[model samples]
Target: MDFQHLSYFIEVVRHASFSKAAQILHITQPTLSKIIKNLEDELEVILFNRTTRYIQLTDDGEIFLKFAHLTLSMADDLQVSLNDGKLLKKGKLSLGLPPVIGVSFFPHIIAKFRDLYPGIHLHLIEEGGKIVEQLLRDAKIDLGVVVLPVDERHFDFIPLVERQLSLIVNSNHTLAKQEIVHLSELRNESFILFKEGFSLNDRVREACIREGFEPVISYESSQWDLISEMVGVGLGIALLPETVLGRIHTESVKVIPKTVPQISWDLAVIWSKHHYLSHPARGWIQFIREWVWLQRSMI
Candidate 1:
């Protein structure tokens, strides 16, 4: 029998009344009864036992119910698989990126992805790395760019950038002339850092603690450019990813190429291990992997 007839039968059995099932299914009671009759005729058996008070399933009806449920389940699975393939042609993706990371990268990658998958709409959420991690956990975004050293147990990540942190000091600062500055030498200096939600905040703090002293904080900001601007004014020194140095146009600050205990500024694209990744999200990860590979080959 057809799926609709089987569904009506299940609803009748659920309510134990043809009138109640018809009301729930938004059809007439007579129509539901006729459909059930046709289903039983097709199976060549009495499917239901009817009485004035209530209705009950016959022996054949109980056996047919099991097969009906299995058939509907398989049909649903087939529909879902077909829909997933259609999604590859047109779908949406939500991606979270820290402000610093977005500025240093992703613009070109995003443009290229749009070129390749013109039908897929992209929604970008800009937040600090810590906030991005929270968004992923909450399932607010499909994928995220976060700083490395994340909880590997909770996330599945692909390493995007592996680099070291560079020190930036004002031109007039004593350490400006030095090509390489030891992390310990900056212990006495006022440090400008990224705000609380940024992963760099913790990374810098942990690195400083490893070097045997805590940094004396002078200011904190969410924007890397603002932090570097404060450094340019001789307010305090800041450590940032070396890749971002090219974008810091403030000639007042000089970047030190080397640090004694080199703190890493690695980045990774992450998604929650527990969350269900949509087709577009999975496609994005694959696209990025290929893009990164192409970039490395060009380099």
Candidate 2:
């Protein structure tokens, strides 16, 4: 019926509960139910198979969901197209950033961007790389920074950071004296790894499997600092990017280069090709390109 109705319907479908969706949408459950009932009456179809606890989409609901999503996306495109000329003077951009990547690289970049384009309001959404990828697919954010090798069919991306992972060990550990270590050498060592949603987690696990052993993961965390802290206390050794290692402040950990079946910590700026990119989003992408180039030139 309207964008609000479509949005409310999508949220209910997403949560699978009318009460939960109402809570998120900041409306009373009765009001939301009435709106949905009105929509169903107008459409001459029941959208949901409702139960006491949750709901499921009916066949008609499933079909309507596709059209609803498309209609909302089209509305967004129309808005962006109409405002294209005005956005350069003042605008807003939403960027989804993984917590690890944000802490490691983007603070300075954000400051620089703000200094250059003070009028543009930048909204940062922090999530794991996997969630960030999902947000891009759903067109929730304008752009996102994710681990490389994204789905090429649905998105366009620019590679930003590419470097090999380094090993972090406690200073008193046996491997601390080594300048370089192989993946196989740590077969017996306990590893502290990032949690499941992070791309780095999968990267480490795959690399370990390739070297003929699954890592003995003693601890898993969402934050890089926590993983590093676990290593500082001699809980376990960890594989992290040098970019992260340089910024982490801990005296008890030793940084060693990884050799043999090198695991790369690659990152990129990504946007959905299926959705429209706003003027501010394009400008931010160009700024990153130049910034990366300048850094490489100096190096």
Candidate 3:
């Protein structure tokens, strides 16, 4: 008998009622009863004992039930093997990334991923680095990009990128002409920083505190350009990665070398240390590692 008829027989036996099995399988009771009848006819034996109040398996039916269960289980394993293809031909992955990092890095990689595994659907969730880390811990996303020096104990990661940060100030600001600026030099300067959920914000504040003073907070925003614009008008100075500088109007703000323990924005792709990655997620991790290796070798 075909798998369809066998599965119907198994479901009918599982519930011990044609009506219940049909409801569970979304088929009609008559259709289920007919299939069971055809299976018994093919086997030349009675499969069910029917009464007004109860439906019970016959002696022969009980014996066939064991084999039926095994067959169905094997079918299930085969289905899983087919669907969860080793090449990531069919699956879904939910990945989290900081907005700036995602905007900078994923465009090419994502397009290439689509070309390689057309059946796999990729869902990207954008948020701040701290929020992305929280999402990873909470299992909201399968994988994420987080800033470095995070709680290493809870994550397994691969280093992504490291970019130098510069001191950004109004072109007319006093330190604008300085070749190299110190973190402590900005101790008294008003700061325009990122909002609370950004790792960069924590890093900036902590650096200031380490330099022996709290940053004088003048403004906070989620967007670096907003921080840059505020700095442009002499609102305050801010620290930003060199990559972001290209996107802003260069003339609006002056960038000076930052050297009091040079600030570098280091990032990594991370996943929960204890979480079991699905085939799709594992495939993504492999792809990222290989891509990173190739990029490095080229350099």
Candidate 4:
């Protein structure tokens, strides 16, 4: 069987959409369909059960997927070994990034990475941390920037940073002058928050529950700037990462330290333990661990 065809087969199942997988593979949908049909004909087993809403693996497909991953992983490794240590001369790195990371430090980090490994093409997806984790598991993304306390048993992660959650209120709001606000103080306050899948949204909600009240959610959004804008106009208060607040000008808002259950998220770059990481992915992880953190030590 052609490993190239097997790669296509894997991408189709991984994405669960012919068009989407085709897009990622940089092939036409008709071409992708033909490739799969050829595989099915050769194997004499239907690999996928297709429907209007979903395309899922058949029994044989599930079995083949395991071998597919192993073979592709080994193929990638073989390429690296044969390259005589000239890693990243050519490769693709599909990565998932949470919006917070995408807007904050991602561009700078990737810029430096590109300067070192200019031959590598990068594909990025900005989504909630939960979705990023799922993409990594599905083999859609080679690596991911996600919020921590992730499943360590199933994946390996290098801690990037821990950002404190800060209380954002309108400058004229009653709590604005306070240096630190206890969770209980906002018992009656309405909050502007990130959408449901976001770890921040869940983290804040659970923290509020621990403090004895459900926070009144006034607005839900994916953009921190929008959430901060809502808070600035007195629509509601918000809790955002200190890293995010530093990037936007919230002139109408006051940022205060949060405690009485201090809220924070540990950021990390993660990849599935079972997935085969390419040389570029492994090298990037090392760069973050060695170079990025070393730079942090200097600061």
Candidate 5:
């Protein structure tokens, strides 16, 4: 059936009045009525029961409404996918990323994507997980690389990598030589943590609370590098993901695995469900999934 006819039919069903539907559609009542009549004839089904004062869907109309909604939704998705392809060929894709993940993977991903689709532009925004989530919710970025267990009701998450949390301490610290340590071991030690609004900070605090004590916070910094640097120089120990450790290596600091309520964080490709996925966004999603699979195979 013609999509326009289905559109009119859906509108009529929604309003339950031809004049109301036409007014909303910015079409005249007679034209709208004609379109619905033509749609019914084509389908060979009575779609509505019209009285002098009211319009109601017939039994067939009710059934058709469900299929109509589905068909329209799919059609819209198909159109969006097609338009996205054109965008990838000529437009740009904006990616919002957390600092640690962006530092490690953004260059490689951008290089690979440019090599494959030279025409598409790649824009990057470096922010913390909370900022990334806000940008996604606001439709500011097409996609985001963020830490997961985020409120999944608003955004869809695709896992990229899962890395264990590490306990970082100055080389001269008492726990520095240990290969593994429990959260309780650091109860009295002053800590350098990520500032408020960061997911990692919340994870670290929650893990500490579960161990029967809150962390002794000497300092908090949103800059990951600064936090690591502080821990390396005997300022205080900090909890960070394995990926961050890989980025900021310091001879003055050591990394040990955490065991009690073993904490790990997921790196995810996140996007809002309310926002439509652009072509480059979809392509990047596929590429990231394949890359993750390949990395797993190698491991």
Candidate 6:
């Protein structure tokens, strides 16, 4: 029940050796062992099974680990929130962004943010939307920019932009000369697409289904550049967001407006309503919202 005991128990589990845990915790091995034993006694459960050379979690310990992690995370957040004013000039802000946004927008924004708040440390992580969502839920990131359709119950989101999706093919491909192509006309054509769980891939599949057939997928990749390169080789055509298309430098590929209903994905800034945002985090969020709005208006 005591935080110190829980901390020691977690360290022991993490290292699987009391001596190593003690070394990491800057405590004696016997002290660390006593803490774990005390934690087990307080909880009325055996937390670990020990041998001369090894330590392993008991079934109860495995379950306890999950709660322990959550408890410690909450405690850390509380401390951070309470100390926010004192830490305002020296705190760290962590952000998560999907690949397209990271490549296209983050550089200038990050540079400006750092210039304005030189004392604040900024950490940005680039990942797929699913990973960014997980990081937000776990409180690993203060803010995340992700393609929309996230679980609205857990996050507060502000729509930044709607990215138009376009059908792209090799410039020399037969379809490239057409200003527009019906979705149904590509029913038999092989498609290079984003991997499963990506918003783009889902949109592409849904569009194809609306046209009366599932697409013939020839390749799937998470990287837009690779998808563009594959499409350039005449392997298959792809449906990608306009933002991603802007990043493509491959000369072989060309965008073709879809004749069917235009498809687009909304990009949003997402944050946990339950998590406390630090001063710097709040500032950066506002800056991002405003910057995105300005860019949208210009476009």
Best by lDDT: 1
3 or 6: which has the higher TM-score?
3
Better of 1 and 3 by lDDT: 1
**Tens-digit lDDT track of model 3 for 237-297:** 9998776777777686998866587877888889999777888888888988988899899
Across 1-299, the per-residue lDDT of candidate 1 in tens digits comes to 68878788889989999899999999999999999998888889998888546788889989998988888899998887668646676778999998888888779889989988887889999999999999999999999998898898889998887889999999899998999888899989999999999999999999899999999999999998999999999899999988789998877999997898899888889999999998889899999899789878998
| lDDT for model 4 | 0.87
Our tally of clashes for model 6 stands at: 0
Model 5: residues >4 Å from true position, as ranges? 1-84
Model 5 Cα lDDT, one tens digit per residue, 141-190: 99988787889889987888787788888999888889889888989999
- Candidate 4 lDDT for residue 297: 86
TM-score of each: 0.74, 0.69, 0.74, 0.71, 0.68, 0.66
lDDT of 2 by residue, 1-299 (tens): 77999999999999988899999999999999998898999999999998645688999999989989999999998888667535564688999998888888779999999988887889999888888889999989999998888889988988887888899999999989998788899999999988888888889999999999999999999888998889999999998877888877878988887667789888899999999888899889898999989989998
lDDT of each: 0.90, 0.88, 0.85, 0.87, 0.84, 0.82
Candidate 2: C-alpha RMSD to true structure equals 17.0
Instruction: Give a tens-digit lDDT track for model 6, residues 1-299.
Output: 67777778788888899999999999999888788877888889988887545888889999999989989999998887657635455678888876756776557888988877787888888777878888888999998888877898899988877767788999998889998888998989999987775666777888889989999999999888888889999999988877667778877988886657777778888899888888888887778778878887897
lDDT of 6 at 47: 81
- Higher-scoring candidate on lDDT, 4 or 5: 4
- Candidate 3 vs candidate 4, TM-score winner: 3
Candidate 6: worst-modelled 10 consecutive residues by lDDT:
81-90
Sort order, TM-score high to low:
3, 1, 4, 2, 5, 6
Kindly report which residue stretches of model 6 are placed more than 4 angstroms away from their true locations once superposed: 1-88, 293-299
Task: Please give the distance, in angstroms, between residue 199's alpha carbon in candidate 2 and its true position after superposition.
Answer: 0.5
